[model samples]
Target: MKQPEIIFILRGATGAEHLALEGAVNLEARLSDPDRRRALVAGFYGFHADAEYCLAPWLEPVEGLDFAARRRLPRIGADLVALGGKPAPSRERPTVTSLGYALGLFYVLEGSSLGGRVIHKQLSHTDVDQRGLSFFDPYGDQTGAQWRAFIAVLDREHAAGRADSKEIVAGALDGFRLARMWLTE
Candidate 1:
């Protein structure tokens, strides 16, 4: 059976998602406290900074896909400071290059915002979470719109025969593994 490209990517990433969620348990535990939230945000900042830096060069030239506009590092950094913590430094290296590769990685990164919304809701009333949830849902009310736009672009790319489902899956899988390692390590 044929599936939408996004669906295909999602199915391919099931294992990676499970692996990444193992690390998320720690973050989930920390969200109950303000100080721990700071450390959690710092850890997230480090992971994202590295991923965004590595993917930016390749994704920059893609129209309607401005990597800068989508970045959470600056906000994450500020959130870390507000929480009385320094921004965590990225220790991971770039794992993929090329536009196709970046897009695949982006699928995982951008998809995270959807789940972030759920977490944001859970933490919305907390003082620290209120201040730091920007990394989770940078677009706020516009998150759905932004996700739809990204999916639209993916559809277009697929229709134009520029999308490589396998590469995208590989990117997403690698992204998940890398994120898990960074968050836990």
Candidate 2:
């Protein structure tokens, strides 16, 4: 039998965690309040910082993938500050020991941009100041193309035997867990 695509595998394995995280984020409630918005951005800063640090070693060397440009920690931090919050002095780092695991983690991070686009649209209708909204729409008009590029890289890696679907799914689950924990805390 032919194997399922890695993206499909990741989406299936991470479906529950992703839903839980979305519920915890409660974008409508959070976006309605300035304090809540700052807190949300701060939580994202913390999670992205740790996630990026974990992914660097594994993803940085991947050709055709500009991992450095994909880093969101800095933009998240800027968003937090713009929203009148500060980054935590430290955060718990998730362990990502393999390329497959890193790709799994990245799948979660990159996939978030899809939701971010929706959140960005929601925020547009809110009274919240727009300065910190950069995190929600980092790619602007290029979001689809950027996502396709990442997916291409993922497919290439899997086809080349550099990553395993199971490990990638596990990484995605962990990523969702980590994101939910930080966001809800």
Candidate 3:
């Protein structure tokens, strides 16, 4: 069996990005608090029975109301304060076509480091996993050469300081919180 530390070491991100992970042991319950719930709703998570999913700011075809409105539940988006840079796109209802540019491609799509292996390792094979839970998981199918070229872009962005550890951590939390809070609340 793999030890927790071993898995953590394999995650390939810096420690700062995983700082909140310790809190997740408790955050699952805290995420249900009414205040946090309100924060989530205000942040634009739409509800579905036991899961609240983000509409990705650019991907349409999401299957729920955009607001709580007494008819649905909501979840929080990233806490930009903690994310360190790059705020989420605004809440206006411009056409979906406009959203890709409005939100920026990097925010919506990962070129090479799509969370594929990570998602599989984390949720698959867990006892209570509900399985098939990663419909929103990131994916990329380019050849190795193509992938290398793509990762170079993320590297450039990082070198330029356009992206950072804090933003990655906060957004990852928002993603899971938006999903798991539904079961608790």
Candidate 4:
């Protein structure tokens, strides 16, 4: 049988972890409270900042992918500051040793934008000030396009034998686990 696409494999491998992280996030409840929302953004900055720092070097050589443009640290930091929280120094550096692994970890981070769009929409209907909400809707109208582009790069990397499916799945799972631990703490 033909192998499944990397994205499909990642989704299947990470389904349970994804659900667990979602439960931990409790986005609706968190977004409803100012303190919780600030904490949430601060957690995001802690996670994404470290993840970006770890993955950037590995992703630098990937052709057709502009890794810098995908960085969310600045946006997360801005959101945290807007929410009156200081961005903390990097705590833990998640291991991203290879291009394949970096791509896998990136899959989880980039995939978050999809759900973030929904959260951004929901927040719009609330009474909360929108100053700190930019991170959730970072792409504005280009979210779908950006996701498609990332997928294309992922597929290209896999097809080029630069990334192994197992490594990708493992990275995604670790990404979810790390995200949950950071966000929930």
TM-score of each: 0.85, 0.93, 0.28, 0.93
lDDT of each: 0.73, 0.84, 0.31, 0.84
Kindly give the stretch of ten consecutive residues in candidate 2 with the minimal lDDT sum: 1-10
How many collisions per candidate?
Answer: 0, 0, 2, 0
TM-score of 4: 0.93
Scored by lDDT, model 1 comes in at 0.73
Question: 11-83, model 4: which lDDT tens digit per residue?
Answer: 7889999999998888777777889889888889988988888998988667777888888889988888888
The C-alpha RMSD of each candidate to the native structure, in angstroms, is 2.9, 2.5, 13.5, 2.4
Q: What ranking emerges by lDDT with the best candidate at the front?
A: 2, 4, 1, 3
Q: For candidate 2, write residues 28-107 as lDDT tens digits.
A: 77776788878888888888999999899999999988999988888888788788898875567888888998999898
Which of candidates 2 and 3 reaches a greater lDDT?
2
**lDDT, residue 147, candidate 1:** 82
Q: Which pairs, if any, clash in model 2?
A: none
Off by over 4 Å in 3: 1-14, 25-116, 126-132, 140-150, 157-185
